[model samples]
Target: MPKADSKFISCKPSKHGSTLEGLAPSTVLKHSLLILFCKDPSTEEPSVSGAETGIFDASRSFHSQRSLIEQQTKDSLQVEKELHLAKSQLLSKKIEDLRREECRCLLLKRRGTELACQILASKSEIDALEARHQAAECEYRQREIEELEEKEKTRDEFYNLRMSELEEFKESIRRFLLDNRDKVQKLQDSVSENTCDLLAMQLVLCNVMPMQLKSTLNLLQGSDGYMDNGRIAAAETKKSELLAEKEKLEKYLISSDHLRTLLQKKLHKMLISQDKKKTKALTKDQVEK
Candidate 1:
């Protein structure tokens, strides 16, 4: 019923325009004729009058039916046009909704691409930083290794020098012992003879002492057998002292060699530990990057 009423309103103006051409005059003429017919009766026979009244009633009923049909036709046309307009508006709204949805989908795709690009860039930077950190760690480890090697080399050289000096001192002691052996043997022979004057004459005969000694030598020349008495023993004592010092230095060198070996082992272990530590640190830094 509401739909039908809305249709009537929409058709009111057009119907009014069309009806203005003839409907208004026709309605006035029809009403005027009805009034005239009601006022005046026929002047024919009574039977004719009754027939005339019936005819007038039939004509009035036909005009009312025609006017009702016209109103119904206008109402139907208005209802159809209103329905069409509503359908067009619904279709437009649906199209607009679809367009908005399409725009939203496009925006979502663009944002996804942007996020992917950002992730890729971040990953690239992280990789680069990790590589640089590993390189720096490697450089630092190499330097530590070089420094350890240098220190060990210097220590070895020092030990070698000390050993060489000890060997040289040992050789000097051996030579001194050899020279003293001869002097001690000769002195023992002379003292076994028990001839002070015989030794003096033997010294002159053997030309062991110079016939004309310098004044400084004459003052200390204890009858030409000075070296045959205590000189050999004194020289042996001095040589033994020097040999002791050389022996002590040799012992120290041996101890130092042992220490060097221990140091080498320790250094090797430390280097391995350092390598492990550096590797772990590099891995951590890479992950952080």
Candidate 2:
């Protein structure tokens, strides 16, 4: 039923009772009229008083039936109102639960978005750090290579310098050896000349000494007669000249002895130097081979 149709129509109990009483009288009058119209045509005419009493009984039964029908309709309307209220409450509860679920979903989605952003930021930082590490590694390798190259270059230059110094030293030693040899040859020539001069002086002395001895013997044999003065004076002059020549030869011999000693010392030093040079040359040749 519609809401308005189900609404109660109010009436005072005393007034309703009086209206039903008045309605009973009017219903009896209508029933009397129906009985008058239904009388048998073939039978004797019915009495007015009897028909009026039957109409009154029928009107009382009709009022009782109408009251029962009205009471049943009121009970049915009360049950329907109770059922509608229960359904409205159930629908309201469902709507509230749906609202709560939607709020929960929104919160979860927002949190998830924040987490995703954080993850991306962390990944980017890792990538940047890796790039820096690689660049540092490359720079370190470059420095090591440069250092090795520089060391190699310096080593080459030092080796070349050492070789040049060795060559110059070898040249100086050769020059010194040649000069020493020349000096020794000149000294040998001087010693030989001095020896030849001493031998010639000795030959002259041997001849002059025999002549002086013969003159002395003749002087001793002719002592009884007066000696010739001219002969004696000539022998004396010749003896003085021979004695002076012998004295000069003795001085030259002493000087030659000192020269010979000096020459021997020089030869010893030259021999030692030559032996050292030969050994050095052999060692150098071995190294070259």
Candidate 3:
């Protein structure tokens, strides 16, 4: 087998030399076959068998290497496809996240716009309410002023009427006092005249009769003595009537004084009440101002 392999290598030295210089596999295979044919017919069998065996081994090695390269290419393509799919999925996820963020931002902007509009509306409503309140206050103040003026006018009218009535009462009281004084003076003059008349009668009686026998003579008197007794009784009755009239006049004067004091007290109270009302009104006006 070794001698046959040596002979086969010697037979194809030039062809093998060309094959080693990077020739195509078909060219190398053609060169090998030509060398095999050109061998002596007596040595052909063993050389042909050795060349065929080497050709078969070379063909098997080429087929195995081709299959290994195809499998490596398929595995690389699969890996590239997987990486591309992963990248696509990652890009899609990023796009989805961005879309969600945009939606959230838009929602926030819309909410902010709605809130701004609500604030403006609230401000306008507050301004309108304030205007209405101011107007109501003005109307209330006007009504209060009118009412106060009416009350003051009524009070003045009432005070004037009361003053007129009080003046009339004072005038009537003065006239009553003046009339009582005249009556009292007249009564005094009458009492004095009656006293003088009584004294004259007493003197005449003393001259006409002894003091011890005066009572006895008056008791046993005839017609002239009886007349003198009647005159004395009439004078005493007149004096008693005058004293009763004087007492009645004194009572009337005292009642009139009490009535005047009560009127004065009532007037003073009314004045105090009016002053209080005035002070209250002034204070109220100041507060309103």
**Cα-lDDT of candidate 3:** 0.64
Candidate 1 backbone collisions, by pair: none
Residue-by-residue lDDT tens digits, candidate 1, 155-266: 6676567557655755664575566556555544544443454445545534632433343245447566354336545545755665575566455555555655665576
Write down the TM-score of every candidate.
0.34, 0.36, 0.47
Q: List the residue pairs that clash in candidate 2.
A: none
Model 3 Cα lDDT, one tens digit per residue, 1-289: 1123443455433533422246566655765554544443334234344545575456556657767998888888889889989998999998999999999989999999999999999999999999999999999999999999999889778767766876675676567557755765565565555555545655654564354346545654855555465655765576466557556655555565565566557657756765675676567557746
**Top of the candidates by TM-score:** 3
TM-score (C-alpha, index-matched) for candidate 2: 0.36
lDDT of 1 at 263: 51
Best by lDDT: 3
Report the error of model 1 at residue 287, Å: 37
**Backbone clashes, each candidate:** 0, 0, 0
Residue pairs in steric clash, candidate 3?
A: none
Error of 1 at 89 (Å): 3.1
Worst 10 residues of 1 by lDDT: 4-13
